[model samples]
Target chain A: MPVTLKDVAQKLDLSITTVSRALAGYSDVAAATRQRVLSTAEEMGYVPNVTARHLRQQRTDTIGFIIPSEGPRFSDPFFNELMAGLGNEAAAHEFDVLVSIHVPGVEEEAAYRRMVYGRRVDGVVIVRIRHDDWRIRFLQQEAFPFVCFGRSEVPGDYPYIGVDGTLGMYLLTRHFIESGHQRIAYIAAPPHFFFATDRKAGFRQALAEAGIPLEKELEILGDLTQQGGYLAMKELLSRFPSADTKPTAIAACNDLMALGAMAAIQDAGLDVGEDIAVGGFDDIPPAAHSHPPLTTVRQPIYQIGAQVMRTLVQLVQHEPLAQRHIVLEPELVIRKSG
Target chain B: MPVTLKDVAQKLDLSITTVSRALAGYSDVAAATRQRVLSTAEEMGYVPNVTARHLRQQRTDTIGFIIPSEGPRFSDPFFNELMAGLGNEAAAHEFDVLVSIHVPGVEEEAAYRRMVYGRRVDGVVIVRIRHDDWRIRFLQQEAFPFVCFGRSEVPGDYPYIGVDGTLGMYLLTRHFIESGHQRIAYIAAPPHFFFATDRKAGFRQALAEAGIPLEKELEILGDLTQQGGYLAMKELLSRFPSADTKPTAIAACNDLMALGAMAAIQDAGLDVGEDIAVGGFDDIPPAAHSHPPLTTVRQPIYQIGAQVMRTLVQLVQHEPLAQRHIVLEPELVIRKSG
Candidate 1:
């Protein structure tokens, strides 16, 4: 026979409402009462039928993580690590992690339909946001409790979290400059994504602060992939002379691109960190093991995911969140590449 | 005013059921009928109120995938690739993928609770099963339709897809022998997982066929992570000296272990290929880039996931399944380490 709340209440000699609240994980329940109810339930192997209870409570205890397949972020390893971190944190917080993938349609409505309608995940964690993204507008209008992995230009009152890409990029560029490098090439991602714009901003800011003029010829928007960086390097080598025109330093938007840059440099008969210095962002596990190692920024993606869950918990608990968007700074992990 | 389904149906001169079925992605709808209904809905500028629909349907259209924290199989790069593949397939099939982290108290029962009680997900995909897994029995008793990523010892009519670990280990072991490695040690994961047993069976089978005696001291079983493998490798080195008891070749259960073995060999002041040729299964991307380029089995994990979802579609549709258990063959990718 399925155990009911009344049976648990009778066994514990407590009122039905008290047993119900304890089972529902209500805060008003005394700690001893909650413990007794939990222990008795465990001993009796009581599994509450939550569907009916959830219908009444309007709480599902699940967080939906939406992975947008707009750019090549889906194929990258950074997203995978972030997912793992989120999975662990969600488990600790007694929440389920729902990962939904939606392809970029002609508009953002289709993507919204996938998450908001068909799936109906509790709260959402939106990754890979674009500049002037309709997703932000849709989420804002709905008043949905969500955290964005990337920031937007027109920031709103949404409690969001993301890496400080501008500062990370500036630090990397400054490190290259201090390492006796000039004419540094910046291999960036597409401007559609917010990170690309922020990274570009940092590069420009660092160059300006160093009293060095920005060279439009040295900046190429790569797709934040090794293949993209390789193609960009090829174009760089072809358009300019090896010694006179080719930049002495290269800062890629990601580790994959930095590795690609290294491959290109070696193929061009130039040694990395000697003939040419190279750096990347998102200091992945392999960043330290790469050929001559890679100088990159550690995004603390795992911690970001942990924080995202913690923040969502606060939101779910109806606690006040920060008015301004919380931006976590990235650290520079220097290695042989620089 | 919100656009209603009935209003859209009346506007299109179609039955409410037909309009509803077309919107819900029922394949039986005529293409012309679907296109007409969709265009009419677009003209009406309808956005589905998921909260209302969820209240009625008692569903989220999200299937949970449970990854056990006990095994290395759950958190590896190959696991990520499998997830990506599954995500793509799930999206194509119009289902959201929910990942639940497996813990002791919050085990597989939590998944069923979320699906049936909380109405968080419709179905589940269970990976890394032991012989006496409670998840299998619970789902079986509940008559819940689920697909196993790996098969069990006592299978009965439930849909299961598996990678042929026996054949994979046989091939890797054969490679080691052919490369003049007579004494080979098997560094594997914990003995509880089905794959570990299957892999051990194949290892013994190959050695018995080659007329090599099976030494109990040669096989070491531990955790599946790189750190786990590193610790196990250190223990193996301490137990077996390089001068006498050392095996010329070591067959690691997975690429993470293979990488760890390489590190262990280098830490022991020994060359990887020259002193101890190491091989691992699961040709993860890093296997190709690792120092000395790990030789490993290239299991089409993405294809496996795709196949599992495709098979689950049959179950969901109540179609005749061609096979109860579908086993995929593993490809041997020979690299410099072997």
Candidate 2:
């Protein structure tokens, strides 16, 4: 049986209210009384009822992370690394990470509402921001504490840490243009994502700088998955039946898609890094291990996850932040693929 | 401002106690009064205080999962897939999944204690069972609800869902033996893990049936990481300086280690499929995409995660479980690596 506050108070011959207040570190209790209460509680193996204490303090000491996923089949290494960062940091601070998976719509909103209105968590960490994200708006409206991994286009200030996708894509695209490749293609993520829009702008910026006209046929939208990238590349190849009319280079918004594009290229009897230069973003673990390897834009995903969690904690505690909005620079990693 | 029970009672012209009892669905409350209270509360947008309700009901409606990890650097796609399954199913049932990462030892024990005694979670899902696991013992002694992913060596009846590692390894090892490879090596996981012990037994069982004497030098222990596998393979190669004396076939306990062994083989100027055959377990997503692809034992990790959670929920609710203990068969997936 677990020791309760009443049991401890009875053993110490003190009032239950006094023992509770002393254990809670309320200054109204004498210093010696507080010390005595702590020692007695420890000796009795008294583990405080966290739910009861949280109700009194109006704090759960939990961080919520609602994964915006398609379904149960969602498997992204990026989320794995990010979750490790968030969970590790939260655990270090004696906070539990409460997680749920919901698509970005009514269900997702309800999950967030439950966490906020029900006081299930102290704060939340938001990822994969969409254009004019309603999550941000809802959190802001409720005055709920949260930190985002990406920024939204909504005209409001919020705390966030985002990678410079536009700059990352620009660097990769510029590398292909400088390599004397005039016929370059890009596989993009869904346009609903904010990073997708930024990345596409970077691709165009590089093409415009080289005085190359943007070809609608060269740009394809993918679902940010391996299969999606494979189908998009197959469609691009089918549009140009002849070898000479095929793209000389392809840039994927993510590593999974890039890997799929590489597979499609190989199936088409085109050698990667020779017939078609391929590059990707978010330098995941497999990026370095792929055949011929992959040239990619590197972002510190784990670090960002950790930082976002730290910021959310600070926000929950009403502490002043060092920076409200941070945009991190992405680095280009040169490999055999590009 | 959030609507409260007091406001609902006042609007409905009922006593606070009556309103509360009616909202709680107490049998003593009159049916017409209950209907009026419910309609008034719904119209007023009254979101009940979950913490207060949980305190009264003695239920948290939260499942705990403590990830046994090295640190923030831990990146495993297997966990990612499992988490997706756990989180998705839990959300469908309106339960939140509480997560924390801790190395196995005192810190991990404290995490479990806090979740149990502090009433932070209604039930816990235990993974990566160690031999004679103390966690199971503690939870059992406390009479807390828990479902394990693997069984401990400790003699007791417990609810668990485990993959048959012994059979999985036996089949892989037998395949190598039939392929005319006498000089086969096995990279084992740490001995403390239950699956590691089972897998090693299977490896030895296959060798014994073939009348091959167990060579201590041919079996190496790996930390179940890519780096660990790489270093173990390097040590195995260093032991036998000549190509003829080195292992012609290698089997790693997990895919990460197998991939590392493949890298080491390539570094030694040996072709993977032609010169040295490699096999791995777990058949993670990277297994299929790996260079030369990995021949591995496939366990439905995502489904297992879902099943574990479902069983845990049933345990917590005191519902009759369909199966108390389940041992699933693992399938052998052959690819180019072998």
Candidate 3:
């Protein structure tokens, strides 16, 4: 049988109400009495019921993260690394992370509401932000604490840690141009994502700087998946069947897409580095291990995750933040592919 | 301001205690009164405080999963897929998942205790079972509900969904031998893991069936990471510098290790499929996207995660489980690597 508050109170020869207040660390209780109550409770093996404690304190001491997933088949390494960082940091702070998976729509809204309005978590860490994201608006309206992994165009300054996607893409595009590849094609993420727009702008900026004309047919939108990249590359190949028209280099918005592009290139009887150069963004683990290796931009994904979680914790605890909005510089990782 | 029970009581012309009890679904409350109180509260935009409701019901409606991680750099796709399954299934059941990270040992024990004794979770999902795992013993002693993703050597029957690692390795080793590879090297996971023992047994069984004496020096232990696999393969190459004594085929315990081994082999100026064959387990997403594509044993990691979670929910709810123990067959995914 588990020991209860009454058992500890009786053992300490105190009123149950006083004992409860002392155990709860209420300032109204005398320090001597609180110490005595704590010792007695520990001796009696009394484990305070967390649910009841949370009820009185009106705090769950938990943070929430919702993985914006399409389905059960969601296995993005970026999210995995981020989740690891969040879980480790949360554990260090003696807090638990409540995780859920929902696609970005009605289900996602319900998940967030369950975490916020349901009082299941004290704060949330939002990732994969979109332009004018409704999630940010909803959270702000509810006055719930949240920190984002990317910026949104929702019209206010909020706590977020964003990587400069524009700079990342610009570096990759410049590398391709400097390598003397004029017919460069880009496989971009869906335009709904805020980062996608920034990356596209960077690509255009690089082309414009090099006095190269932008070809509308060379820019293809992908679903930010390997299959999407493969299809986009296939479509590009079909559009430019002749050697003179085919792109000499390809740049994908993310590593998965770059990998898919490589596969498509190999299937088309072209050597990756020899026949056509390729580069990617995000520099996922597989990028380093791909056949010819991938040259891409690096984002400290795991560290960013840890930082976002730490910011969310500070917000929940009402602590002063080091920086409310941080834009990290993206680093270029040069490898064999380009 | 949030609506209070007293407000609902006054609006419905019932006692506050009656309204609270009605919301809590106490059988003593009259049905009409309960319905009236619920509707009036909903109309008044009253959201029931979940912490208080859990206190009254002694149920948190949350499940816990502790990721046994070495550090924050833990980016294993196997766990990612499993988590996705667990998260999606939990969401479908309207149950939240509480995740934490801790290395195995004392810290791991404390994490389990925090989830179990602290009453932060109604049940736990245990993965990466060890030989004679103390976690299973503790959960059983506490009578806390839990379901495992792998079986243990503990002395009782428990609910679990496991992949047949022994059979998986047997098929892979047999394939290597049939492909005219007489000299084979095995990269094994840490010996403490139960699956490691099973997989080793399978590797030996296949060699014995082929009448090939197992070369003790050919087997090396890997830390189940790509780096570990690379170092292990390097050590094997050093041990047999002569081409005549070097292993013709390398079988890593997991895909990450196999990828590392491939890198090591390539660094030694050898072609993967032509000079040396490599095989791995747990056909992760990257395994398919790998340069030559990895030949591996496929474990339905996502499905197993969902099944384990479903079983855990059933156990927590005291529902009759369909099976107390399930050992799934592993499929051989023969790719270009082998």
Winning model by DockQ: 2
lDDT of each: 0.77, 0.89, 0.88
CAPRI band for model 1: acceptable
Ranking according to DockQ, highest score first: 2, 3, 1
Consecutive 10-residue window with the lowest summed lDDT within model 3 chain B: B69-78
Better of 1 and 3 by lDDT: 3
TM-score of chain A of each: 0.84, 0.94, 0.92
Candidate 1's C-alpha lDDT? 0.77
- Tens-digit per-residue lDDT, B1-338, candidate 1: 35768989998888889999999889989999999999999888776655456557655555778766653213467767677778888777776677876654455566566565444556678777777777778777767678899878754678889889999999999888888788899998777788898887878888988999999888998577776777778888888874777888989998888787777787788888888888998887667766677899888777788778777766765678898788888888988787
> Candidate 3 — which residues are off by over 4 angstroms?
A16-44, B11-43
For model 1, residues A1-338, the per-residue Cα lDDT tens digits are 35667888899999989988898799999999899999997777666654445545566677877676545224556766678778888877878787766557643356565455433556777766788877778777767677777688755777678889999999999998888777899998888888888888888888999988988999987877677787888787777785777798999988878877787887787878888888999887667656567899888777777778778867876888764377888999998888
Candidate 2: list runs displaced more than 4 Å: A26-32, B17-36
Q: What TM-score, over all chains together, does every model reach?
A: 0.83, 0.96, 0.95
